[model samples]
Target: MTETTPLNDIIASRIARQGRITFADFMAACLYEPGLGYYTSPGRKVGAEGDFYTSITVHASYGRVVAREIAQMWRNMGSPAGFTLVECGAGNGRLACDIMDFLAEREPVMHQSLRLVLVEQEPSLESAQREMLAVHIDSLSWLSPDEFASGSFTFSGCLYSNELIDALPTHRVVMTSDGLKEVYVTCTNGEYAEEAGEPSTPELEAYLKRVAVELHPGQQAEVNLNAPKWLASAARALQRGFILTIDYGYTAHELYTPLRKLGTLLCYYRHQTEENPYLRLGLQDITSHVDFTTLMEYGEELGLQNAWFGEQYRFLMSAGIIEELEDLERSDVSDEEKLRLRLTLKKLIVPQGGMGDTFRVLIQSKRVTAPRLLCQRRIGG
Candidate 1:
């Protein structure tokens, strides 16, 4: 018996007009509607006090490690004079700031030729991104999601995102004796409910077929067709360079197993996980775990090489976490601060149940061959 929110009313009206909408459309309205959706609305969505915590919230060290890897990507491309780094879902620009700071200090040559394109769906976030990345304003630009994925915004250095894909609207489907049926949203006594019907797009079935996934009977799952479509757009946009995506997900095989029959759709509100997505409408953050296998497979088909994919800890360790720790130890900070820094960093690499293993990193490249990325190095290196 939750009260109807403005977003809820809007969605209900849409459903009333259209006679029920697909879950994906409902999610899009809930999370990205003009002024009241989860992301489009004005409220904190990340970090300790927000709905959920992303890797950027853990520490600056996380982004520094990613910067170290980006430097390697530049080196892999043979030190291009005009390199561009496009970061989609650039929230508050914290990660970009950390990367820019590290690049300006350590890889000055690369920084001199670098241009960063921040692509965010919410245009209002530009002000916050601008404020956070004020020091690197000379090298920054902004692009809307439509503009970034329009197959016109070309870049050359690298494109990256952290926890971006899971937030994209995804259609839900359930396996039945008859066949795969999509889960659509319908009004039941003025409350949102689910109904099984034919999929809105044939791509949902084809996505599973392409990934060689066959869900067990009665297995309910989410299909993020937008992911591959987005990747295709990313591929088309990147004339050359690499695509780095960091998020929490699994391969198609692991993701479609019978153990997880209910799929990975999750909601976050006030730092707690909520099972029902219908409660607060735009208030809670709804997300589905990404499917990395489709990314790797579809990337290959789109003329991108699957460079690397693994746990976050491995990426951080092999890339530059140890070096970051060493630098902190040699810094002017006090011993107590160093200890706190060490513990904070541990949160990024602590194995099992921690962020380290739960999250993952996937790197794909276009036109770069035999690239020697920092993530391929030994711990000390």
Candidate 2:
């Protein structure tokens, strides 16, 4: 209850009986287990009080910037009278709050016409989102994945998620002279250790084949089979809209560089990032940097076009964040509140030692071309 109690024990028991579990299994239990997983345990997982932090939690302005972008996107879509705006993995609803606030203040009509859906699998978090959006209860709706994935819902407008992809279950592999070997977990005297299992899943083998990149010998990397599936599902669920993904990662070319032997698997505990995911069990957060190249390419295969890609900082800047800051500076609010807002903005925009550099944004569209997006320095630009 205090830490990752029940889930950790469950995983440890599996390790005790079996030699070790696969990294994917370990992560799935740690993060998505019925009630004991880190995400479901109800501790601080998004703010400073939690084990890790996200940009939206850092500042309300982060969400405000996003809201502005969404507004622009709405206009680009011809301001559909009943456009759908879906936010999956809507953690803590902070971003939703910001966007809602922006709508109320800026585009009241669009706010009224919009249909907002917050899709979260966790009941506890769903309850939290309900509380956060109580004022807009009429416009907002909540659904579990089971409800939405039942193949009954159709959405159009925008599909957005922040820091969602990295959490998907991924198969871990280490490249050796002998070729790629999966890193599965095993039990050793009641403790868990990793051992090589098999080559790769049939789908994973084909994914690697298409990406056509070779990992350095002894390099350990994560391959997320769930990512493409998730995106594909989003594409299917969405009829005429854009799928916007924001995460940390590189293209395949940069990810599998020869100079870099270690892959992008990592863990975070009490805000300290580390390489060993086997420690602390369900108490800490485990994640892999997303491969945007995989997302762009795979999503495109599903009829989504790569609209744009850039760092979070550039995206926020392009959304007129500076003007928002200046407005806040001139507002009737107290200096203390203004200072706090500025600090939050700084945390989101600082190029080094900040979330801006740590995060990247990939925008893909369906049935539309790229609009005049701002503040992005593309890879080739």
Candidate 3:
């Protein structure tokens, strides 16, 4: 692929004039910059033809199962009449469709109480979302932080996202034999090159201290400054509700281990993983694994009580996902529909080659009583 991305030009020119740009700048440009960035552009990001597959794209049951869990959370919150279900980074509205469809069928009362909100940043994705959700646009509202903040957004329901956090910009740093240095991308000789810069800011140093705890010498890792910011913002937006985050990542200790020397930064294009994000700047998707520990800690600091955390498979199993299958089987459904249902159920919880272990689920609540959460450790004592 040619390295002629407009985003790269803008970023490279800035780096050329300013010496070095932080990984955060690089990431933001590569993913969110105007019309040329990967996420900001009109491209298939999640699905068979896309760079990766999210649970919602894998099967509709993913959203259905998640909706059931949300219903349970609503019930735990006394089944408030004006509950909201806000889905962040809603791509193509597939998840919303599945969740609302299941809720409409099974819990019509709670479904009627639902005010669905999709908070997406990119206009292209939002346009696509509107088209995908045209039939249900009346029931759903496209929202942003400002729009969500306009009202007394004290949610009595769940605020959820899937495969969302990993896409946030992160700072990549390495502890070399010489000392700590930030990684910077530069156009050198003829191609994009990576060089070490000075130690990151004091703030970054402190973040690294926490992230690099117990890390052996020369270990490399990524710091998601945006993750905590997002959590804090979410915490502020939600006056009273649960924050459900689902993503693929490890704890801080694991992410900073010596074995992870090259860090978790990666790119995906057409379902294939690539290490050279610069090569396919606008065409591919750039992502880093999230630090679950960071998310949990920051969320708690923002008054979001840690409710539960577990592997996606365990979460699904505990949320009675299999019961949905049994119900489908027992119902007088058609043979084809039953087969599809069985296949979807298998994809969700059947462990090997399925989403069971690959994804994870974390639920945190604010101003909510400690309720027994399925598939997770007990809520705050």
Candidate 4:
């Protein structure tokens, strides 16, 4: 039997009062329901002790390479004196720390002008972020996600996120003989179950049309209406700068292929992949693959240009991973440690059962005239 959690009871009560709720609503509650949610009530969420590993956990080099890209972005924008670096979903501030450390040491001018605004949904994480980013205390600031997207916050520097969009609540749908039907959650016998019905919003159908996707009969897919909405807000806040998004996903054509009958919705717990999101309630992390096509298309509509889009490996390799590896070799670490670190860095760029191809990087810009980014260079050129 699946164990019941405090969030389970809260979600059950919500369903009892609201009849049936959309899967998106259930997922949002599971992930962001104040103190009981998985992320909001986190206890080490992104390392060996946590449910999963991200590129950041692999090595500091990942963020350093990203930092290199951001430095180049600063130069591309004429090195604005008051550049603000905003990181949405800044978890524990590890990446921000690494980036700031690199800039402080190497790109001192840009670092001097850099102001990092962390936008996190969980308020309690601010302490952890502050502690992690203590060295750059003067450069650090915090903002709630709502405030960051409220149209009041504007910035003229790069905004970046790693593995963020996939966590936003996604509406699941299945192609039935009748038509596209939304997956809804209902409580029966005090347990959660799924039922398909008319979509709660017409935007679901319009989303598929925007991507030109047609699901085969009985094929299940997740429509992330929230991703585009988030992009819209990000675009609105960027007066003249770039948005760098790194996450695991595909273009709309690859994501909604008929072969992938079951959508990419997944649950992660203790490093194990769970097919059943209903089992753990808020204890496990539920996420779906981001759709880059929608981000690109919707970004254009929001007056942002798709500057670059490619796999993580290509971005890292072209950006600065090789130089980072060379620096590791020049360092005074033991030979065995160097080899170990080399292998660890390989995990970030190797394809075939690795994070390299699975994760993608999207760079979008606004009001930048022919902005040339490091990731746009030819690999090995």
For candidate 1, give the lDDT.
0.92
Q: Is candidate 1 or candidate 3 better by lDDT?
A: 1
Give the root-mean-square deviation of each candidate in angstroms.
Answer: 0.9, 3.0, 3.2, 0.8
Our tally of clashes for model 1 stands at 0
- What does candidate 2's lDDT look like per residue over 1-381, in tens digits? 223456656887777776566677888887888777768676778777887888877777777878887787787788889978899889878788888888879999899888889887677887688888888778888777766666677888888899888888788887788877888876554455678767547665667766887777888777788888788778888888788888887787877677667678888888899777767767788888888888888887889888788778888877767868989988999999898878878778778747777788898888865665544434224
The Cα error of candidate 1 at residue 219, in Å, is: 0.5
Let me know the TM-score candidate 4 reaches against the reference structure.
0.99
lDDT of 1 by residue, 1-381 (tens): 556899988888788888978899989998999999999999889988798999899999999999999999999898988799999899889999999999999999999989999999899999999999999999999999999887778888899999999999999999999999999998755688889998888999999999999999999998999999999999999989899999999999988898999999999999999988888999999999999999999999999998889999999999999999989999999999999999999999998989998999999999998778888887666
> How many clashing pairs in candidate 2?
7
> Each candidate's lDDT (Cα)?
0.92, 0.79, 0.78, 0.94
Q: Give stretches of model 3 more than 4 Å off.
A: 145-154, 211-214, 331-341, 350-354, 376-381
Q: Please tell me which model should have the higher lDDT, number 2 or number 4.
A: 4
Q: Estimate the TM-score of every prediction.
A: 0.98, 0.92, 0.91, 0.99
- Residue 8, candidate 4: C-alpha displacement in angstroms: 1.1
Better of 2 and 3 by TM-score: 2
Q: Give the deviation of candidate 3 from the true structure as CA RMSD.
A: 3.2
Ranking by lDDT: 4, 1, 2, 3
After the best TM-score superposition of candidate 2, give how far the Cα of residue 108 lies from its true spot, in angstroms: 0.9
